[model samples]
Target chain A: MKPLLSVRGLSKRFGTRVACRDVDFDLWPGEVLGIVGESGSGKTTLLNCLAGRLTPETGSVTYNSAAYGTVDVHDLSEARRRLLSRTEWGFVNQDAREGLRMGVSAGANIGERLMAVGARHYGDIRRTASDWLDRVEIERGRLDDRPTTYSGGMRQRLQIARNLVSEPRLVFMDEPTGGLDVSVQARILDLLRSLVGSLHLSAVLVTHDLGVARLLTHRLMVMQGGAVVEDGLTDQVLDDPQHAYTQMLVASILPV
Target chain B: MMDTISSSSSGPKEHDGPVLKVAGLTKSFIVHAHGDLALPVLRNVALAVSPGECLALVGPSGAGKSTLLRSLYGNYRADAGSIRVHHDHAWAELVGAEPRTVLDVRRRTMGFVSQFLRVIPRVATVDVVAEPLLRLGADPAEARDRAEFLLALLNIPQHLWQLPPATFSGGEQQRVNIARSLIVDYPILLLDEPTASLDAGNRDRVVELIGQRRDAGSALVGIFHDVGVRELLANRVFEVSP
Candidate 1:
């Protein structure tokens, strides 16, 4: 199948520091690609490039969609990019707080996306927001509460709801499970597994945890110093460490 | 699960002396811009967070999480259902409470970390952190001392402690938000998504601090949507039903 997203020769720099250099990748529909690396390895930098949060100095991001047809994501009109971000692209941050407006009610947070896409009926927006809240397992009663009043775990869950409420075709999750506890992490992993299967959406997950990649990814990419060192099937690369860096990473994960 | 921790920090749960409580809470608004009609935002809902228990509320966008949080804080008055709180040796609803009573609840009992970190625009970090303490009538020297200690605990460099938090990074601003919420020693602490803009390292530090607050005897309720964050703090998770 033709890929949903394709990136070629992408590069980004901050002053003299190179964040991403000549990065290349492709994402197919319903595929989960895990990007793993140490701090400053450019995993997040690459995500920024993909999401258009950072404009790369060079390269192209092509999006081939059934509804919108093929277009270079990097070269789209500003209006088109806004539409894509508001309606088609979902970005989940490592910190849920970054993704949510803590000042608003949960209902408003979820409904805001629908409203952005021209959902004007109050009843419809509330019902839709309520439905998503239930999907994420929050109480309907708490929908009016400001996000600031919620706990850390609750905020994270709220962030997921905020992103997923829009029903994007592709989602980018940066270190989705980095700060969670074991049981909560397991539950979230299970939730992601089910959500992707049911929604039939593609995901680009960035993390340092091999366990997270092992649970949710179809493919894996190892990054170091702003470049990809290896890319392969998750099992293949995880089971038979070909590169020395990959071997160290595989060895570093605590045995479950 | 309850008895393994320290004793000096232990206190009664929020239910025993709930600063905020609601039963059959419901709210709605007239959408003048959206085809004339009253749209219900929250259906009949009821919940209470006990003191010292970090109750997590998770849901998709538009799930009314913020509405519910605001209702408890007396920001949005519910259309129906009674919100009652035990305040000043009496139980009363914060909605329409006397001004002094509302002020007292805000100052002496509950600390809210708003989504926007509303810090003084041009004040030093120590003063910003110490503001809550100063508001509660602490001596300036004592407040500054407490603020300095908290800044260190948050790993903010001593040099930055005397400077304006406005000049800090996103992560640094978030730490100040945490310190500001914690300085007052309020019995109940309400935090909206506290670590949204943080990088991985700073994110972990914030999570650890939330855990520390739970250990410090303050009843906490927060809205979070990150799976990792929910995993770390939610002793009980409530998912809004479809």
Candidate 2:
């Protein structure tokens, strides 16, 4: 089958500091790939490049868009790129507040995404928003409340409902569960696990937690100092790590 | 004889005293606008869960399976029944226990995994998972470390440890819920569609974890919609008819 997204010679740098170097990979449909590395590693940079949020210094990121056909993400016109991000792609931010419109009601936030996808009926949009809220475990009665009034977890769930309202084909999540209490993290992970399966979503998840990589991803990529150090199936990489960095990463997890 | 041997080997035998018992458990709801209709959800439901055994609840939708599970967890009050749970080496009636006693039992003896994850906004995922351990008087650092291990096992990425799970996908959120409930070794576990949203691979992982817990002597009561998982985990089956 044709790969859903492909990256070749992908490199990104900030001034003299290299964020990612010579990273190459292919993401198939319905696959969850995890990018694992410590802070300052190029995982986030590579994710940003792949998601078209940051321009790469060299190489190309290509996605097989059902609407636009195979296209270079970076080379697409700004309007078209925005359309793709709004329609075919989703970006889940680490800080939910950053991704959500804090000023608007949660219902409106979710409705906005539906409207962007050409949904015009007010009643239908509201009902959809309400449904999404329930799916994410938020009470339907709180639909009219602003995100500012939502608890940290509620805000994050609202952000997810907003992004997924349009049914994007691929999602880019940067620490989607970051900064939550352990109990809360577990719940979110459970939610994400189910959503990914039912939706058949292809996602590039950037996380430093090896456990997350093991549980959610089919494949894994280990990044260090802005380079792809190792890549393989999730179990193979985790159980019998080939690269020294990957070994250390695996060893660092506290035994359950 | 062969069937008896295999069944006994696979699951706890009935000779062993049950960890949880219910008798004549009935619940009803009043329909406000339907001329004061009393909608009876559960009728004389009786069941027992032995240590190291899993009792699977099988029934169609609207059969009150979830309501039965919640009543077992003390989340709902049974209208007419004695719900007894073994704790502190004695059986205590949960039907009308004091709130403090119920809370104590929940904290130390019973663990529940509900269908929906209740996310407390602004708390980090690690802390959320670690709360049970903290309540059990574990060291803060130890609790956090254990929580990380469980989170990783459930496939929650590390970066999200410090963030709230509210923004996570349905699957990710569900994994978090599993990790939290499974973190502490409660004597009795109540699971409601635990693997409803998990992929095959993750679902297997959860089954493995549950098996481990059962082997460690935890009695389990669960509602498994997935027939395969239900067959794999449940040694005893209880069918609830609507």
Model 1, chain B: what is the TM-score?
A: 0.84
Q: Pick the candidate with the highest lDDT.
A: 2
Q: Considering just chain B, what TM-score does every model have?
A: 0.84, 0.92
Model 1's i-RMS, to one decimal, reads 28.6
Q: Model 1 chain B — which ten-residue stretch has the worst lDDT?
A: B1-10
Model-by-model DockQ, in order: 0.01, 0.02
Question: What lDDT tens digits, residue by residue, belong to model 1 across residues B93-114?
Answer: 7654533345467667777776
Candidate 1 lDDT, A77-128, residue by residue in tens? 7888878887888888888889999889999999988877678999999999
lDDT of 2 by residue, A182-248 (tens): 7677767777876886687999999988877776777788999999997766655676465667767
lDDT of 2 by residue, B1-242 (tens): 11110111112222368989999999875433445567788999999888999999988899999879987877666678989988876788988665445666787789999766777555688888887767666777877877888888777889998998889888888889998888788889999999988899889888888877787688999999999999899999998888
Lowest-scoring 10 consecutive residues by lDDT in candidate 2 chain A? A233-242
The local lDDT score (0 to 100) that residue A143 gets in candidate 2 is: 94
i-RMS for every candidate: 28.6, 25.2
